[model samples]
Target: MTAPRLLVLQPSQSDPLAKLGEWLEAEGVELHLVPLKEEPAPASLDGYQGVICLGGEMGALDDLEHPWLADARRLLSSAVSQSLPTLAICLGAQLLAVATGGQVRRGPQGPEVGVLLVAKRDAAGMDPLFADLPFTPDVLQFHSDEVHVLPPSAEHLAASPKYPNQAFRVGSSAYGLQFHIETTPEIVLNWAAKDPESAACARPTDFDLDFLAEAHRDFEEVWQPFVARFAKLVRGELSPAGCLGTQLPLV
Candidate 1:
Protein backbone atom coordinates (compact mmCIF):
# COMPACT_ATOMS: atom_id res chain seq x y z
CA MET A 1 0.00 0.00 0.00
CA THR A 2 1.16 3.50 -0.69
CA ALA A 3 2.05 5.63 2.30
CA PRO A 4 -0.27 8.51 3.18
CA ARG A 5 1.10 11.75 1.75
CA LEU A 6 -0.18 15.32 2.28
CA LEU A 7 0.67 18.52 0.44
CA VAL A 8 1.58 21.38 2.76
CA LEU A 9 1.25 24.86 1.21
CA GLN A 10 3.25 27.48 3.07
CA PRO A 11 2.01 30.97 2.22
CA SER A 12 4.18 33.05 4.49
CA GLN A 13 7.72 33.15 5.75
CA SER A 14 6.44 33.96 9.22
CA ASP A 15 3.59 31.54 9.95
CA PRO A 16 4.09 27.79 9.85
CA LEU A 17 2.43 24.70 11.30
CA ALA A 18 4.97 24.05 14.03
CA LYS A 19 3.14 21.58 16.29
CA LEU A 20 0.63 20.25 13.81
CA GLY A 21 3.40 19.14 11.47
CA GLU A 22 5.14 17.34 14.33
CA TRP A 23 1.98 15.44 15.27
CA LEU A 24 1.29 14.45 11.67
CA GLU A 25 4.91 13.26 11.31
CA ALA A 26 4.51 11.06 14.39
CA GLU A 27 1.48 9.49 12.68
CA GLY A 28 3.73 8.25 9.86
CA VAL A 29 2.15 10.65 7.39
CA GLU A 30 4.56 12.05 4.83
CA LEU A 31 4.50 15.77 4.13
CA HIS A 32 5.40 17.56 0.89
CA LEU A 33 5.98 21.24 1.54
CA VAL A 34 5.27 23.78 -1.21
CA PRO A 35 6.51 27.31 -0.77
CA LEU A 36 3.58 28.70 -2.75
CA LYS A 37 4.58 32.33 -2.25
CA GLU A 38 7.86 31.82 -4.04
CA GLU A 39 6.97 28.95 -6.38
CA PRO A 40 4.04 27.87 -8.47
CA ALA A 41 1.15 25.78 -7.18
CA PRO A 42 1.47 22.11 -8.15
CA ALA A 43 0.00 21.46 -11.56
CA SER A 44 -1.97 18.56 -10.17
CA LEU A 45 -2.91 16.73 -6.95
CA ASP A 46 -2.25 13.36 -8.64
CA GLY A 47 -0.35 11.32 -6.03
CA TYR A 48 -1.15 13.13 -2.82
CA GLN A 49 -3.65 11.59 -0.45
CA GLY A 50 -4.36 14.91 1.26
CA VAL A 51 -3.61 18.66 1.17
CA ILE A 52 -3.13 21.30 3.87
CA CYS A 53 -2.74 25.10 3.45
CA LEU A 54 -1.35 27.11 6.36
CA GLY A 55 -2.09 30.74 7.28
CA GLY A 56 -0.27 33.85 6.01
CA GLU A 57 -0.15 37.54 6.94
CA MET A 58 -2.15 38.50 3.85
CA GLY A 59 -5.82 38.46 2.93
CA ALA A 60 -7.25 35.63 0.87
CA LEU A 61 -8.42 37.91 -1.93
CA ASP A 62 -5.12 39.67 -2.60
CA ASP A 63 -4.48 37.69 -5.73
CA LEU A 64 -3.07 40.37 -8.04
CA GLU A 65 -0.36 41.67 -5.70
CA HIS A 66 0.13 38.09 -4.56
CA PRO A 67 -0.74 36.41 -7.84
CA TRP A 68 0.04 33.05 -6.35
CA LEU A 69 -3.17 33.24 -4.31
CA ALA A 70 -5.19 32.68 -7.44
CA ASP A 71 -3.35 29.45 -8.00
CA ALA A 72 -3.66 28.46 -4.33
CA ARG A 73 -7.40 28.93 -4.50
CA ARG A 74 -7.53 26.97 -7.74
CA LEU A 75 -5.59 24.12 -6.12
CA LEU A 76 -8.01 24.01 -3.18
CA SER A 77 -10.97 24.06 -5.53
CA SER A 78 -9.49 21.20 -7.48
CA ALA A 79 -8.75 19.19 -4.34
CA VAL A 80 -12.35 19.45 -3.19
CA SER A 81 -13.58 18.41 -6.60
CA GLN A 82 -11.29 15.40 -6.36
CA SER A 83 -12.59 14.65 -2.86
CA LEU A 84 -9.12 14.57 -1.35
CA PRO A 85 -8.75 15.00 2.40
CA THR A 86 -7.86 18.67 2.97
CA LEU A 87 -7.24 20.86 6.03
CA ALA A 88 -7.25 24.62 5.42
CA ILE A 89 -5.91 26.58 8.39
CA CYS A 90 -6.51 30.30 9.11
CA LEU A 91 -5.92 32.27 5.92
CA GLY A 92 -5.92 28.99 4.06
CA ALA A 93 -9.46 28.49 5.28
CA GLN A 94 -10.34 31.91 3.99
CA LEU A 95 -8.79 31.03 0.67
CA LEU A 96 -10.76 27.80 0.67
CA ALA A 97 -13.84 29.84 1.46
CA VAL A 98 -13.46 32.14 -1.52
CA ALA A 99 -12.47 29.25 -3.74
CA THR A 100 -15.55 27.21 -2.91
CA GLY A 101 -18.23 29.88 -3.48
CA GLY A 102 -17.94 31.52 -0.08
CA GLN A 103 -16.99 35.07 1.01
CA VAL A 104 -14.38 36.63 3.33
CA ARG A 105 -13.78 40.21 4.39
CA ARG A 106 -12.46 42.30 7.24
CA GLY A 107 -14.17 40.83 10.29
CA PRO A 108 -16.86 43.20 11.47
CA GLN A 109 -15.91 42.23 15.00
CA GLY A 110 -12.27 43.11 14.34
CA PRO A 111 -9.39 40.67 14.56
CA GLU A 112 -10.16 37.73 16.85
CA VAL A 113 -6.74 37.60 18.45
CA GLY A 114 -5.67 35.32 21.35
CA VAL A 115 -6.75 31.87 22.44
CA LEU A 116 -10.48 31.36 22.77
CA LEU A 117 -12.99 28.59 23.39
CA VAL A 118 -14.97 27.32 20.40
CA ALA A 119 -18.01 25.14 21.01
CA LYS A 120 -18.95 22.28 18.78
CA ARG A 121 -22.20 22.86 16.98
CA ASP A 122 -25.02 20.32 16.95
CA ALA A 123 -24.11 19.43 13.40
CA ALA A 124 -20.59 18.56 14.51
CA GLY A 125 -21.93 15.40 16.14
CA MET A 126 -22.25 13.86 12.69
CA ASP A 127 -18.83 14.97 11.45
CA PRO A 128 -16.12 12.34 11.20
CA LEU A 129 -13.24 14.59 12.23
CA PHE A 130 -14.79 16.94 14.78
CA ALA A 131 -17.10 14.61 16.71
CA ASP A 132 -14.47 13.58 19.22
CA LEU A 133 -13.29 17.01 20.24
CA PRO A 134 -14.19 18.75 23.49
CA PHE A 135 -17.45 20.67 23.84
CA THR A 136 -15.36 23.86 23.86
CA PRO A 137 -11.93 23.15 22.43
CA ASP A 138 -9.27 25.80 22.91
CA VAL A 139 -8.30 27.20 19.46
CA LEU A 140 -5.79 29.90 18.61
CA GLN A 141 -7.40 32.86 16.85
CA PHE A 142 -5.25 35.52 15.17
CA HIS A 143 -7.11 36.43 12.02
CA SER A 144 -8.30 39.85 10.84
CA ASP A 145 -10.88 38.61 8.34
CA GLU A 146 -13.45 35.85 8.84
CA VAL A 147 -15.30 33.41 6.61
CA HIS A 148 -18.53 35.28 5.95
CA VAL A 149 -20.40 33.03 3.58
CA LEU A 150 -19.65 29.35 3.49
CA PRO A 151 -20.45 27.39 0.37
CA PRO A 152 -23.93 25.92 0.22
CA SER A 153 -22.36 22.47 0.39
CA ALA A 154 -20.48 23.19 3.58
CA GLU A 155 -21.63 21.85 6.95
CA HIS A 156 -21.01 23.95 10.03
CA LEU A 157 -19.04 22.02 12.60
CA ALA A 158 -17.44 23.99 15.46
CA ALA A 159 -18.06 27.63 16.28
CA SER A 160 -17.27 30.36 18.76
CA PRO A 161 -20.10 32.48 20.14
CA LYS A 162 -18.46 35.56 18.71
CA TYR A 163 -17.36 33.91 15.46
CA PRO A 164 -19.98 31.56 14.09
CA ASN A 165 -17.78 30.27 11.30
CA GLN A 166 -14.88 28.97 13.34
CA ALA A 167 -15.03 25.57 11.63
CA PHE A 168 -16.73 23.78 8.78
CA ARG A 169 -16.45 20.68 6.64
CA VAL A 170 -17.24 20.55 2.96
CA GLY A 171 -17.79 17.45 0.83
CA SER A 172 -16.51 14.43 2.77
CA SER A 173 -12.86 15.26 3.21
CA ALA A 174 -12.43 19.02 3.01
CA TYR A 175 -12.23 20.89 6.32
CA GLY A 176 -11.82 24.58 7.12
CA LEU A 177 -10.79 26.17 10.40
CA GLN A 178 -10.98 29.92 10.98
CA PHE A 179 -8.66 29.60 13.96
CA HIS A 180 -5.05 28.45 14.15
CA ILE A 181 -4.64 24.94 15.53
CA GLU A 182 -0.88 25.04 15.05
CA THR A 183 1.32 27.87 16.37
CA THR A 184 4.27 28.28 18.70
CA PRO A 185 4.50 30.71 21.63
CA GLU A 186 7.06 32.77 19.78
CA ILE A 187 4.76 33.09 16.82
CA VAL A 188 1.87 34.39 18.90
CA LEU A 189 4.17 36.76 20.83
CA ASN A 190 5.60 38.15 17.61
CA TRP A 191 2.12 38.56 16.16
CA ALA A 192 0.96 40.33 19.27
CA ALA A 193 3.90 42.71 19.45
CA LYS A 194 5.05 43.29 15.88
CA ASP A 195 1.80 43.39 13.95
CA PRO A 196 0.58 46.93 14.44
CA GLU A 197 -3.05 46.04 13.78
CA SER A 198 -3.15 42.80 15.80
CA ALA A 199 -1.30 44.54 18.62
CA ALA A 200 -3.87 47.31 18.67
CA CYS A 201 -6.89 44.96 18.70
CA ALA A 202 -6.53 43.79 22.29
CA ARG A 203 -4.64 44.33 25.49
CA PRO A 204 -1.01 43.38 24.81
CA THR A 205 -0.53 42.78 28.52
CA ASP A 206 -2.94 39.88 28.20
CA PHE A 207 -0.79 38.24 25.48
CA ASP A 208 1.16 36.63 28.33
CA LEU A 209 3.50 34.27 26.47
CA ASP A 210 3.78 31.98 29.52
CA PHE A 211 0.01 31.77 29.83
CA LEU A 212 -0.31 31.29 26.06
CA ALA A 213 2.11 28.38 26.36
CA GLU A 214 -0.15 26.74 28.95
CA ALA A 215 -3.15 27.36 26.71
CA HIS A 216 -1.31 25.81 23.75
CA ARG A 217 -0.64 22.70 25.84
CA ASP A 218 -4.40 22.54 26.33
CA PHE A 219 -4.80 22.84 22.55
CA GLU A 220 -2.31 20.02 21.96
CA GLU A 221 -4.01 17.60 24.33
CA VAL A 222 -7.20 18.00 22.33
CA TRP A 223 -5.99 18.68 18.77
CA GLN A 224 -3.03 16.30 18.43
CA PRO A 225 -5.43 13.37 18.49
CA PHE A 226 -7.57 15.29 16.07
CA VAL A 227 -4.68 15.59 13.60
CA ALA A 228 -3.97 11.87 14.07
CA ARG A 229 -7.53 11.11 13.15
CA PHE A 230 -7.12 13.15 9.94
CA ALA A 231 -4.00 11.18 9.05
CA LYS A 232 -5.98 7.99 9.54
CA LEU A 233 -8.68 9.33 7.30
CA VAL A 234 -6.11 10.02 4.63
CA ARG A 235 -4.64 6.51 4.96
CA GLY A 236 -8.12 4.94 4.87
CA GLU A 237 -7.16 2.87 7.91
CA LEU A 238 -10.18 4.18 9.82
CA SER A 239 -13.66 5.17 8.82
CA PRO A 240 -15.23 8.43 9.89
CA ALA A 241 -16.40 8.12 13.51
CA GLY A 242 -19.52 10.15 12.61
CA CYS A 243 -21.75 11.45 15.39
CA LEU A 244 -20.96 10.02 18.82
CA GLY A 245 -22.39 12.92 20.79
CA THR A 246 -20.48 15.15 23.20
CA GLN A 247 -17.63 13.06 24.61
CA LEU A 248 -16.70 13.60 28.20
CA PRO A 249 -13.09 14.59 28.54
CA LEU A 250 -10.93 12.47 30.84
CA VAL A 251 -10.48 14.10 34.19
Candidate 2:
Protein backbone atom coordinates (compact mmCIF):
# COMPACT_ATOMS: atom_id res chain seq x y z
CA MET A 1 0.00 0.00 0.00
CA THR A 2 1.14 3.54 -0.66
CA ALA A 3 2.15 5.58 2.37
CA PRO A 4 -0.40 8.17 3.38
CA ARG A 5 0.49 11.56 1.94
CA LEU A 6 0.09 14.82 3.85
CA LEU A 7 0.25 18.32 2.43
CA VAL A 8 1.92 20.64 4.93
CA LEU A 9 1.50 24.36 4.35
CA GLN A 10 4.14 26.44 6.08
CA PRO A 11 3.13 30.09 6.28
CA SER A 12 6.38 31.58 7.47
CA GLN A 13 10.06 30.96 7.65
CA SER A 14 10.09 30.86 11.44
CA ASP A 15 7.61 28.07 12.05
CA PRO A 16 9.01 25.03 10.30
CA LEU A 17 7.55 21.65 11.19
CA ALA A 18 10.62 20.70 13.26
CA LYS A 19 9.71 17.80 15.56
CA LEU A 20 6.17 17.51 14.25
CA GLY A 21 7.41 16.81 10.73
CA GLU A 22 9.91 14.33 12.12
CA TRP A 23 7.20 12.54 14.06
CA LEU A 24 4.85 12.35 11.08
CA GLU A 25 7.58 11.12 8.76
CA ALA A 26 8.66 8.61 11.37
CA GLU A 27 5.11 7.32 11.33
CA GLY A 28 5.63 6.60 7.59
CA VAL A 29 3.49 9.43 6.21
CA GLU A 30 4.85 11.17 3.13
CA LEU A 31 4.91 14.94 3.59
CA HIS A 32 4.84 17.55 0.84
CA LEU A 33 5.75 20.94 2.21
CA VAL A 34 4.75 24.19 0.53
CA PRO A 35 6.37 27.27 2.00
CA LEU A 36 3.54 29.70 1.37
CA LYS A 37 5.78 32.74 1.42
CA GLU A 38 7.86 31.38 -1.41
CA GLU A 39 5.43 29.10 -3.23
CA PRO A 40 1.80 29.15 -4.20
CA ALA A 41 -0.61 27.00 -2.23
CA PRO A 42 -2.40 24.36 -4.26
CA ALA A 43 -6.03 25.08 -5.16
CA SER A 44 -7.35 22.03 -3.32
CA LEU A 45 -6.54 18.98 -1.23
CA ASP A 46 -5.99 16.87 -4.33
CA GLY A 47 -3.95 13.68 -3.82
CA TYR A 48 -3.27 14.30 -0.14
CA GLN A 49 -4.82 12.11 2.51
CA GLY A 50 -4.29 14.76 5.16
CA VAL A 51 -3.38 18.44 5.44
CA ILE A 52 -1.61 20.53 8.07
CA CYS A 53 -1.17 24.29 8.22
CA LEU A 54 1.63 25.48 10.48
CA GLY A 55 1.70 28.63 12.59
CA GLY A 56 3.22 31.98 11.55
CA GLU A 57 3.77 35.48 12.88
CA MET A 58 1.16 36.93 10.53
CA GLY A 59 -2.36 37.51 11.76
CA ALA A 60 -5.08 35.42 10.17
CA LEU A 61 -6.54 38.39 8.33
CA ASP A 62 -3.27 39.77 7.02
CA ASP A 63 -4.00 39.10 3.40
CA LEU A 64 -2.50 42.39 2.30
CA GLU A 65 0.84 41.35 3.71
CA HIS A 66 0.70 37.72 2.61
CA PRO A 67 -1.58 37.10 -0.29
CA TRP A 68 -1.10 33.36 -0.17
CA LEU A 69 -3.07 33.39 3.05
CA ALA A 70 -6.27 33.52 0.99
CA ASP A 71 -5.37 30.33 -0.75
CA ALA A 72 -4.33 28.75 2.54
CA ARG A 73 -7.70 29.55 4.05
CA ARG A 74 -9.46 28.10 1.05
CA LEU A 75 -7.48 24.89 1.38
CA LEU A 76 -8.26 24.63 5.08
CA SER A 77 -11.93 25.22 4.36
CA SER A 78 -11.82 22.55 1.72
CA ALA A 79 -10.19 20.05 4.05
CA VAL A 80 -12.79 20.62 6.75
CA SER A 81 -15.67 20.44 4.30
CA GLN A 82 -14.41 17.13 2.98
CA SER A 83 -13.75 15.69 6.45
CA LEU A 84 -10.16 15.07 5.48
CA PRO A 85 -7.79 14.62 8.39
CA THR A 86 -6.60 18.17 9.10
CA LEU A 87 -4.47 19.86 11.72
CA ALA A 88 -3.98 23.59 12.07
CA ILE A 89 -1.68 25.17 14.62
CA CYS A 90 -1.74 28.67 16.11
CA LEU A 91 -2.07 31.19 13.29
CA GLY A 92 -3.19 28.32 11.14
CA ALA A 93 -5.91 27.61 13.67
CA GLN A 94 -7.00 31.21 13.48
CA LEU A 95 -7.20 30.90 9.71
CA LEU A 96 -9.19 27.72 10.06
CA ALA A 97 -11.61 29.46 12.40
CA VAL A 98 -12.19 32.29 9.98
CA ALA A 99 -12.46 30.02 7.00
CA THR A 100 -15.20 28.06 8.70
CA GLY A 101 -17.38 30.83 10.14
CA GLY A 102 -15.51 31.60 13.36
CA GLN A 103 -13.58 34.63 14.60
CA VAL A 104 -9.94 35.52 15.31
CA ARG A 105 -8.39 38.67 16.64
CA ARG A 106 -5.71 40.16 18.86
CA GLY A 107 -5.80 38.37 22.17
CA PRO A 108 -7.59 40.68 24.61
CA GLN A 109 -6.01 39.05 27.64
CA GLY A 110 -2.51 39.50 26.19
CA PRO A 111 -0.04 37.27 24.43
CA GLU A 112 0.16 33.72 25.70
CA VAL A 113 3.71 32.41 25.42
CA GLY A 114 5.77 29.58 26.86
CA VAL A 115 5.18 25.94 27.63
CA LEU A 116 1.67 25.80 28.99
CA LEU A 117 -1.17 23.41 29.68
CA VAL A 118 -4.64 23.37 28.11
CA ALA A 119 -7.35 21.31 29.77
CA LYS A 120 -9.36 19.05 27.55
CA ARG A 121 -13.05 19.81 27.54
CA ASP A 122 -15.64 17.10 28.21
CA ALA A 123 -16.35 16.95 24.48
CA ALA A 124 -12.76 15.85 23.85
CA GLY A 125 -13.40 12.55 25.58
CA MET A 126 -15.04 11.21 22.44
CA ASP A 127 -12.91 12.90 19.77
CA PRO A 128 -10.78 10.61 17.67
CA LEU A 129 -7.81 13.00 17.87
CA PHE A 130 -8.18 14.23 21.43
CA ALA A 131 -9.80 11.39 23.37
CA ASP A 132 -6.60 9.73 24.53
CA LEU A 133 -4.67 12.84 25.47
CA PRO A 134 -4.06 13.78 29.08
CA PHE A 135 -6.75 16.01 30.53
CA THR A 136 -4.17 18.78 30.64
CA PRO A 137 -1.66 18.41 27.87
CA ASP A 138 1.63 20.30 27.72
CA VAL A 139 1.84 22.56 24.67
CA LEU A 140 3.93 25.47 23.50
CA GLN A 141 1.95 28.70 23.28
CA PHE A 142 3.43 31.56 21.25
CA HIS A 143 0.69 33.61 19.68
CA SER A 144 -0.87 37.03 20.11
CA ASP A 145 -4.12 36.25 18.33
CA GLU A 146 -6.98 34.16 19.72
CA VAL A 147 -9.83 32.21 18.24
CA HIS A 148 -12.58 33.57 20.45
CA VAL A 149 -15.50 31.99 18.64
CA LEU A 150 -15.35 28.58 17.07
CA PRO A 151 -16.91 27.76 13.71
CA PRO A 152 -20.58 26.92 13.98
CA SER A 153 -19.93 23.27 13.29
CA ALA A 154 -16.93 22.98 15.60
CA GLU A 155 -16.69 20.81 18.68
CA HIS A 156 -14.73 22.47 21.48
CA LEU A 157 -11.97 20.19 22.63
CA ALA A 158 -9.72 22.07 25.03
CA ALA A 159 -9.26 25.39 26.80
CA SER A 160 -6.93 27.50 28.88
CA PRO A 161 -7.97 30.24 31.29
CA LYS A 162 -6.99 32.97 28.86
CA TYR A 163 -8.03 31.44 25.56
CA PRO A 164 -11.24 29.49 25.59
CA ASN A 165 -10.90 28.16 22.07
CA GLN A 166 -7.60 26.43 22.55
CA ALA A 167 -8.46 23.31 20.59
CA PHE A 168 -11.42 22.29 18.50
CA ARG A 169 -12.65 19.98 15.80
CA VAL A 170 -14.42 21.43 12.81
CA GLY A 171 -15.53 18.11 11.38
CA SER A 172 -15.06 14.49 12.29
CA SER A 173 -11.43 14.54 11.19
CA ALA A 174 -10.38 18.20 11.05
CA TYR A 175 -8.68 19.50 14.18
CA GLY A 176 -7.30 22.91 15.13
CA LEU A 177 -4.83 23.53 17.92
CA GLN A 178 -4.18 26.97 19.34
CA PHE A 179 -0.79 25.95 20.67
CA HIS A 180 2.34 24.39 19.30
CA ILE A 181 3.23 20.71 19.39
CA GLU A 182 5.75 21.11 16.58
CA THR A 183 8.66 23.12 17.90
CA THR A 184 12.20 22.10 18.76
CA PRO A 185 14.14 23.84 21.53
CA GLU A 186 16.20 25.76 19.02
CA ILE A 187 13.16 26.92 17.10
CA VAL A 188 11.56 28.25 20.29
CA LEU A 189 14.76 30.03 21.26
CA ASN A 190 14.83 31.69 17.88
CA TRP A 191 11.24 32.84 18.30
CA ALA A 192 12.03 34.32 21.71
CA ALA A 193 15.05 36.10 20.36
CA LYS A 194 13.09 37.53 17.46
CA ASP A 195 10.09 38.74 19.44
CA PRO A 196 11.15 39.84 22.88
CA GLU A 197 7.82 41.52 23.62
CA SER A 198 5.81 38.38 23.11
CA ALA A 199 8.50 36.30 24.77
CA ALA A 200 8.17 38.46 27.87
CA CYS A 201 4.76 36.99 28.52
CA ALA A 202 6.44 33.71 29.33
CA ARG A 203 8.32 32.72 32.43
CA PRO A 204 12.04 33.47 32.36
CA THR A 205 12.90 29.80 32.42
CA ASP A 206 11.04 29.25 29.16
CA PHE A 207 13.97 30.58 27.16
CA ASP A 208 16.64 28.66 28.95
CA LEU A 209 18.07 26.08 26.54
CA ASP A 210 18.07 23.31 29.09
CA PHE A 211 14.57 24.05 30.21
CA LEU A 212 13.30 24.31 26.64
CA ALA A 213 14.99 21.03 25.72
CA GLU A 214 13.51 19.26 28.71
CA ALA A 215 10.09 20.70 27.90
CA HIS A 216 10.41 19.35 24.36
CA ARG A 217 11.17 15.93 25.78
CA ASP A 218 7.96 16.09 27.77
CA PHE A 219 6.11 17.48 24.76
CA GLU A 220 7.20 14.60 22.54
CA GLU A 221 6.14 12.04 25.11
CA VAL A 222 2.57 13.28 24.75
CA TRP A 223 2.37 14.53 21.16
CA GLN A 224 4.43 12.03 19.21
CA PRO A 225 1.80 9.37 19.71
CA PHE A 226 -0.82 11.93 18.90
CA VAL A 227 0.82 12.55 15.54
CA ALA A 228 1.03 8.83 14.95
CA ARG A 229 -2.68 8.49 15.50
CA PHE A 230 -3.25 11.38 13.08
CA ALA A 231 -1.14 9.55 10.56
CA LYS A 232 -3.21 6.42 11.10
CA LEU A 233 -6.35 8.40 10.47
CA VAL A 234 -4.81 9.66 7.24
CA ARG A 235 -3.84 6.16 6.15
CA GLY A 236 -7.28 4.72 6.80
CA GLU A 237 -5.86 2.51 9.52
CA LEU A 238 -7.91 4.32 12.15
CA SER A 239 -11.60 5.20 12.17
CA PRO A 240 -13.44 8.31 13.31
CA ALA A 241 -15.98 6.15 15.19
CA GLY A 242 -14.92 7.89 18.39
CA CYS A 243 -16.67 10.97 17.08
CA LEU A 244 -19.91 9.03 17.46
CA GLY A 245 -19.16 7.66 20.94
CA THR A 246 -17.88 4.33 19.69
CA GLN A 247 -14.49 2.71 19.16
CA LEU A 248 -13.49 0.79 16.07
CA PRO A 249 -10.69 -1.75 15.98
CA LEU A 250 -7.62 -0.39 14.26
CA VAL A 251 -7.02 -1.92 10.88
Which 10 residues in a row give candidate 2 its minimum summed lDDT?
A: 239-248
lDDT (10s digit) by residue, model 1, range 7-51: 999999788879989999999989999988777889999889999
Q: Name the Cα RMSD for model 2.
A: 3.7
Which stretches of candidate 2 lie above 4 Å from their native place?
241-251
TM-score of each: 0.92, 0.95
| Winning candidate number (lDDT) | 2
Can you write out model 2's per-residue Cα lDDT over 137-179, one digit (the tens) per residue? 9999999999988998688999999989999988788889999
**Model 1 stretches astray by more than 4 angstroms:** 203-205, 240-251
